[model samples]
Target: MADEEVWKAIDDLHAWLDANKAVDGPEALLLRVLKLSEEVGEVAQAVIGATGQNPRKGTSHTWDDVRSELCDVVITALVALRTLTPDAREVFATHLAGVTERSLDGRTP
Candidate 1:
């Protein structure tokens, strides 16, 4: 999907979450930000499971599960950013551009 569509979906998800949330204001924003940590932990768990790192589990998850968990982390992060500001799309795009430039240093390889 396009960037615009992804942002629109994130906006909609944020609105839905806000409407259903029990808390509001700063508390809600804090919780939303904390949710990103939980998603990140899930990604770690998925990676471990996929690699059979936990002897007790023995490969309970596949690579696709890790991918899904990573996607969840991204979505949760974007939603948290949207909670912080309405210009999440622009903010993310600008930060991504700067990172890309710094990492590539004008090289195509």
Candidate 2:
């Protein structure tokens, strides 16, 4: 998906959440932030399972599952950021640009 499309979807989801009173104030904000951690943990679990790192639970997940979990982490993080500020897309874009420039040193990787 395009960057704008993802932002639009996040905005739509936030609107629905707000309408349903799923997000209200400070406490809800904390929960939204913490949700990112939960999603990250899932990604770690998927990775471990995919790599068969845990002998007792060998091959519990495929690489595709790890990919999906990572996507979930991204979506959750974006949503949490949107919950904190309306300009999440611009904020993220600016940060990403800075990171890309620094990592690539102005040259294509």
Candidate number achieving the greatest TM-score relative to the actual structure:
1
Worst 10 residues of 2 by lDDT: 15-24
Q: Distance from true position, residue 39, model 1, in Å?
A: 0.5
**What TM-scores do the predictions have?**
0.94, 0.89
Off by over 4 Å in 1: none
Model 2 residue runs over 4 Å out of place are 21-23
Look at candidate 1 and tell me the lDDT of residue 94: 95
Candidate 1: pairs in clash: none
For each candidate in the order shown, give its overall lDDT on alpha carbons. 0.93, 0.89
